[model samples]
Target: MKTLWDYTIVLQPDNNGTFVAYVPAIDGCHAWGETPEAAQSELENVFEMIRDEYIEAGQALPDNVELVASHAR
Candidate 1:
């Protein structure tokens, strides 16, 4: 059985009140939804698609990473 990899995702609330999510390790991989939960669900789908593409192309997967949440005043 193949081991499942987990990637850290960053979720941020935009000015419009919607939530946006992205994987810090994957460039151009992101998704947005009205709620944080929805955003996270959409992001999960995006991650799977990107992973599949990488597998098909024989490309190395993005490195697993984590980002600390910080607020800017």
Candidate 2:
């Protein structure tokens, strides 16, 4: 059986020429990179770690969570 986890990536400029990727849903799941693609790859790695931790702890994972991106003023 497989499940889907919703993730949102927000890019924020850092002090240097790099950017930081923030994943709010997952704790301690943030990554910094010189480009967006690199940040995304790092985020994937963080996500895998989170998933593994949950599985090892025998926790009940939630169903597919969809991330809805909307602009609100």
Cα lDDT of model 2 by residue, 1-73, tens digit: 2322364556677899888886665567788889977877787787677778888999754444346789999
Runs in model 1 deviating more than 4 A are 1-5, 68-73
Q: What does candidate 2 score on TM?
A: 0.67
- At residue 71, candidate 1 shows an lDDT of 96
lDDT of 1 by residue, 1-73 (tens): 1112377778899789999998788897799999999988888788888878888998888677766768999
For residue 25, model 1's alpha carbon misses the true position, in angstroms, by 0.5
State each model's CA lDDT, in order.
0.80, 0.69
Instruction: Compute each candidate's TM-score over C-alphas.
Output: 0.80, 0.67
List candidate 2 segments past 4 Å from native. 1-5, 60-73
- Model 2 global lDDT (CA atoms, 0 to 1): 0.69
RMSD of 2: 3.6
